[model samples]
Target: MSDIGRTSAVALVGVRGTLVEVEAHLTSQLPTFSIIGLPDTSLGEARERVRSAATVADCPLPSRRITVNLTPASVPKRGSGFDLAIAMAVLAAAGTAPGADRRTVYVGELGLDGRVRPVLGIIPVVLAARDAGVDRVVLPVGNLAEAQAVPGVTLTGVDSLRSAAIDAGADLPAGFVEPVLLPVPSDDTPPPLELADVVGNATGVRAVITAAAGGHHVLLLGPPGAGKTMLAERLPALLPDLDTDAALEVAAVRSVAGHGVRSWTHRPPWEAPHHSASAAALIGGGSAQLRPGAVSRATRGVLFLDEATEFPRVVLDALRQPLEAGRITVHRAGGSAEFPARCQLVLAANPCPCGNAGTVGGPACTCPPSAVRRYLGRLSGPLLDRIDIRVAVARVTTGTLRASDGTAPTTDAARRSIGDARERMRSRLRGTGWTTNADVTGAWLRSDGRAAPGASDLLDRALDLGTLTMRGWDRVMRLAWTIADLDGDDRPDRRHVERALALRMAL
Candidate 1:
């Protein structure tokens, strides 16, 4: 047989960019192994691990000069995920390792003693391979569940390189067992805080419901313990379960970030980053290769910012682009990387330095009006205009707090109502390519002018009164359509427009 041999393919695990392919070649020469293609430190070390794993698996090491090339050499590859693929490719090219089928993509990290270890982002990588017409995939035994989540792809799990080599038509090693799929466990529990426990903040509750129904951005101004965080946490529960495409998108992001969903159920994701989080952490970035950040991880979900005013102005301001474009671009020395950041933003902040600034009960306000203005002024007008609903939360009274005699509606009840409203909105925007009111542009909103007659007149009046800017008018009109949709109306009416305007002015 000819000594010159090559085996090459790609592996991808993220939607932020294209798939990554790995290629390997072997030739008769000095016994040296080299890996190319912009591999990071971890990937560069795969040469040693692959050789030891092959030896332990009873596969003869190639006594030749081996060169492995990962295509698109400019893109930096991280993690040990390429270990198994690289090793298999080397062995196949050396005419030793088993199962050299080009239709199957192998992904896993191999230990020196021949054990296969799980790696992150297997789900998206396998899905990408399947979409690219690859018929089968072999992954670490531990990652089979995640890989199996994607249908129509033949998934095989291997515990050691020995079994893989044997399956590939090589000599079998002793004490090798076929890998089996592990059963994934399920944990179903209700959310911690129910809307009924929120006591009396009827206006706040209404705003929360409306925001949830239309996937609108919300801002909550209240004291430290005014239930703002509680309301924000429950918003995710109010959102309808994610559809298939959205679920896949969310799963892909989590996988790339080395996290996985506990269950395959398509519940909306919730992400609440602390006030001290950096701009890079909120958006996404790293040294060599960029990774998904909180916003990208929370795509098609909710991102709650607590203690909003405490965050650095620069960090908070970085959100403007994503808020407007539904995506974030991280510029680097080599090039720019983009990530999806389309999410419902809920910001909770204290009213003033003392946090007791407009509340009826509490210590006397010591903060000057200038301090209060400065605190609130940190929020830019453009950012505030992007937010659809703004409500001030107030403390609940003792009687209202104690009156929860199981008579009030549970979160499930609220969720059902919100779910119905969301379905209605989705039906209305089926072919419009819009998922929520906040996503609708000015042109689209104006196109349906005659559809909602009084909406235009009311918006014009608000603009004339200087109560709303041009951008604010469009956002408020969008909110009006959302309100109408929540009320099961075909189009926004004068009442819906008035309610939306009222919510906007409440800030």
Candidate 2:
């Protein structure tokens, strides 16, 4: 005699998920088990784990040939989250448990002790199930809170294979012991970094405000201890909170990167990769499973690259694509995956290797001119051109440090200004499918969002004189619009254009 059982599962590729069918076939032959449908190394090992777990859970497989297949077979599936579905399918085919509902998606890794352990990317997996119109999901108990973050889905959290089988209408032996659920670790958010803590560097602070206001990238060049890092860190505080869709997207990225997502928050993320990070680490690639990199993690937030010049030139140059496209696609031998990377890039670097070459009145420079040029040359022209704001942060004098007149900008004040500016941008770009000045194209800016009459004369001159590329002209126009919005102007005027030009040429 022969029997067939089927269930559903989700395969995550980057932040997206694809629904996969788990089908098991039982036949009266010598006892053997095999899994097919392009399973990866970790997924292929599910055979042993499922067998051991089913036995310990008192749901031993029938003494018959078993063939488990994940279809459509062309799609490459990775991870051990498929264990539960495979086990349930085998048991159902053996007539031990009732067949699983095809509408319900199963997602969780199984241990040898019959425990169903949580796996990464549950958020995206559940999200995929929701997107695929599968409203019910059976996952590990540990991920209940995370799965609850996504609405419109009925969740059934199981602690063990036996409990899952019982939930699936299996006739198990009596003496059911209630399973103990482990408490999910709380997602504790640290206190917000205050903008008021920065002592000096008014220009640096203003540059950060412009960045937060328009979602523009910034480059901060200065000596050490000039408050560059402080300014960069506080930019997020000056921006508004993320909306529901954005928060969910960010949570999905975190979940896929193995950073547990207990709940979603409106606060944007911040990623600061070290200089020693490889290209794969920054751009997102791996041999086993393609993972999200720092750029993807910083989607809808800030990506701070401190000591920017210390990074490898290739690694620095790799950011151009994500900055331009607002998304990153990692190609591997297995396949390709895309991740959202629309982030505000904040780069802080010393003027030279010795860190005192550009200071007004600090230690004398010891590094040679060639060394300084080489250090700064690591930042390619193409990469630098993509940055919208370039400001030189000079060392703060002792007099300036002590001359606080109680007029320093606070996070609340900056946030209000940025929020108002962003609102204005959204209004202006209502039907354009864009919400920030930086996202507007040159054609749109020239035709619809043009500056006041005769306001762009200097910009025209610069463009004609070969000092600025077309890309630079567009960037300056965007910066000018952001400045005008911050000042409550109907449109950019001469003053705004001049200020934007000065900021762009500050380095």
Candidate 3:
């Protein structure tokens, strides 16, 4: 009888589940290794790479017929992350390696030249492994930093198949060395853009501060030279640092997208896609596999759309779903993939084609009222309804320029205020599962019944006069809460409500 044995391991096809098992068997037949599974080209080729890697590592190759079967073979495997796993299984079956059943997951792409290459989605993969009671994971050296981001998992980085084999006791290479900690990248702090740099637009600055505090979406309609882009860039300065969970979410998106996850500590991402961005680029759609688009990458951060009106209607409409659901689902021939997209939207657009629709100092407007209406008409009412703040930015005047002294607080001051406001809101809505005012539903807003007496009357009048939709009414109430929180008030008062309404109707 031929001596036969099997070793087990796992591989991640997508972000969905933990590794599928790869069973390696050696039998009495012509020397040949065959891989049986629904594997893509990259995965199927792992057989040849593993053989060469073992040879380079000076490990003995089985002279008998070798066959590898990936169990639950119905599911597809797409990457070379299975190379190390397959190699380990082969060694274990030959009685060359030890610790084959201690729940150790391996993930890495093997280069034909025996180098371990980085693979995508390492963060999520390691996290899944850690959660599934897997005590340790062996990943490509380049991916060690990302794998380290996940706590509770003992991560070992391998440089080549030979190094990995020596660690597993498969074959003792000439110079076997212990695993070294991957060098961590030095932290680079982004220079802060101060609110004091803005010449005027005190009201606009305050509105942005409120948006940061409550996670509200804002639209800025202004003529040329109104500093719309400048203001949008400064919004991140007012935002609080990303929390631990939010930081991981942002890092995961970047990791899978092949962008290295630097520091997830306090950085807030800011994505400013050009107006020419396609629908797929904005909302994430591709042929076979759906990759994350700009909106998805902007999760838990800011998505600034400058010249928002210039974008196609289709692209603009795609944002509505993610904006409401905090995530987007992209369906394709293979399957659907969902990406987190909870972001603070900041849209800046010129008032009209002439860029002088309502400016005080500008050339005479030749476009008719119909054209102006059509220009703004591109933005649907439903979309406008979702935006909580609509402020009109005016061109800076001579007086405003003179007042651009350092008298006002800097960006640090505004950031502190935003932090304080967020803490207050989080405490109040702690048990309610609401993170910010923008996340509170209309029912919750009304149920609270904490609105000021005169403010309720004003809100009722707006609803009665058709000035506010049901959604708009809720957003106004949310804004009132944010304003009150900023002013250190325990409850929203009439002045806060009035100010909120004024900011909403600024455009």
Residue lDDT tens for model 3, 377-398 = 7777888888999999988888
Error of 2 at 23 (Å): 0.9
- Which structure among the candidates has the greatest lDDT? 2
Best to worst by TM-score, what's the order?
Answer: 2, 3, 1
User: lDDT of all the models against the reference?
Assistant: 0.77, 0.89, 0.79
- 10 residues in a row with least lDDT, candidate 3: 176-185
> Against the hidden reference, what TM-scores do the models get?
0.91, 0.96, 0.91
Which ranges of candidate 1 are over 4 A from the true structure? 1-22, 72-75, 174-192, 261-263, 334-336, 398-409, 449-451, 464-466
State the displacement of the C-alpha of residue 422, model 1, in Å, after optimal TM-score superposition.
1.8
* Model 3 residue 315 distance off true place after TM-score fit, in angstroms: 0.5
Show pairs that collide, candidate 2: none
Model 3: residues with Cα > 4 Å off, grouped in runs = 1-17, 30-32, 175-190, 261-263, 403-407
lDDT (tens digit, per residue) of candidate 2 on 1-507: 999998899988888999999999999999999999999999999989999999989989888899999998988899999999999888878777784857889988889988898888888999999999998999988788777878889999888899888888889854343443444555544457888787767788889999999999999999998889888888878878998898999999988876664446688888899999999999899877899999998999989999999999999999999999999999998899999999999999999998999677789999999999999999999999999999999888878887855456888988999999999999999999898999999999889989999999999999999999899999999999999999999999999999999999998
Instruction: Give me the runs in candidate 2 sitting further than 4 Å from their true place.
Output: 173-190, 402-404
Q: Tell me each candidate's RMSD, in Å, in order.
A: 3.2, 2.0, 3.1
Q: Pick the candidate with the highest TM-score.
A: 2
